[model samples]
Target: MDEVLADPIDKFISLYQRDHGFNYTLEQMHGKEFGELLPEELLPSLRVYLNQKGFFRDLKVIPGAIETVEKLCEKYEVFIVSAATEFPLSLEDKQAWLADHFPFISWTNIIFCGYKIVDVDIMIDDRARNFNPKIGRHLLFTSPHNVGLTEYERVNNWAEVAEKLL
Candidate 1:
């Protein structure tokens, strides 16, 4: 759920700009895979960087994420769930990242697994397929790449999410 609360693409752009001079703005990256948007030669290495050390640690918090999550936590049993099996290398890094950025969240509240199989009243995620409608209502966290996915309820930013649920 880092993508729901962290701006990884912006962090990648900064790193990519420093190493390869790929001066892309976030708006232009909307609706496209960040790696595919890069020059072909850089794609492989950049994708490798995704799970590398220090990558998740430096990601900036998505605008309004901290405040919104704090508000939600006050009113609900907030769980910071993430699909972690795909990036085995990132499990610890992601946990460290959460502790570093979200000190208010307890270790017991974090759930890491392959599929998001938890049963809950609602789930907010950037990826559309992570939640099943029969199990819970899905609130799509609008990210650049997921902006065009319109099948579910979409919240453009945390403010909208707060408006809907809080």
Candidate 2:
């Protein structure tokens, strides 16, 4: 969720990769898409520009995120059901990252997957559409870029976000 805003250009690039069949540097695919679609060559430099401009890591954790999650852990069986894959970041890396940054989470409590829909009490995710009926409740982490999407319980901050679940 935080990454989406911190790197909107990356999101656009990722979307472009999804739409097209190539997964190379923007320069490698230059002159492919016409007009605003993006000049393949310029994408690499644009990415560099975004990085140098500090757009690469500006994601701020929602206020009270830690407190809310900690509180939620007390009342509910809290689990992080994210869409990120285990590649690039291995299980160890993922666990370490979480442990280092989100020390509040118990290692056994976290579940990482590229695709997940387990029979659990509830699920919270940025991609709310991925919520399965098998799960109890769904909370959509609404970001500025995804506000136009329809039909889900959305919350911008974790304080309001906690009320829905616990």
Candidate 3:
């Protein structure tokens, strides 16, 4: 739920610009793997931000996400499935971030997995790598990174999600 529930790249870019003095827009990186698509020199340096402290702690919640998730939680089970293991420092930060913004989602429902092997009815995420046909329905939450991809059902924002799901 990193990009779906909150705008992590915004924070990442802000930090990258502040440190590296170069601005990288999210749209410029769309439809491609970041490490592979970005400049060879910049990729490794900018990637360090992912492992930094508080990278995931202070993320701005995506617009309409709180309202939509709250509404969904009332009628259906809601859980957070994050690839936290990939970035070890993110586990605590992501949990703290969720507790701060989405306290209604119990800690038990917050899962930290290396792979998106969740057995759920619906999976809402911005990353295309998380999509698996066997994992039931997949809703591609629109983000600059995944906006160009049309292979999966897309939700532009939580309003469209509320319209479609609720």
Which candidate has the highest lDDT of all?
A: 1
Off by over 4 Å in 3: 32-38
lDDT of 3 at 74: 86
- What range of 10 consecutive residues in model 1 has the weakest lDDT sum? 50-59
Quote the positional error of residue 88 for candidate 1 in Å: 2.1
Of 1 and 2, the candidate ranking higher by TM-score: 1
Tens digit of per-residue lDDT, candidate 2, span 1-166 = 3322122434445645675554545453232322235555655654443334233233344557777877887887776654445343344544555565567888677776766857786666656557888876776765544456677777766767767766
Best prediction by TM-score: 1
Question: TM-scores of the models, in the given order?
Answer: 0.93, 0.61, 0.91
Tens digits of per-residue lDDT, candidate 1, 1-166, equal 6678877888888888898887999888789778768878777887588768677766888888889998899999999888876777878878898888888999999998988888788899998878786656888888878878878899999999999998
lDDT of each: 0.84, 0.56, 0.83
Candidate 2 vs 3: which has more TM-score: 3
* Model 2 lowest lDDT segment of ten: 1-10
Clashes of 3: 0
- How close to the true structure is residue 26 of candidate 2, measured as C-alpha lDDT? 41
Candidate 3 TM-score, C-alpha based: 0.91
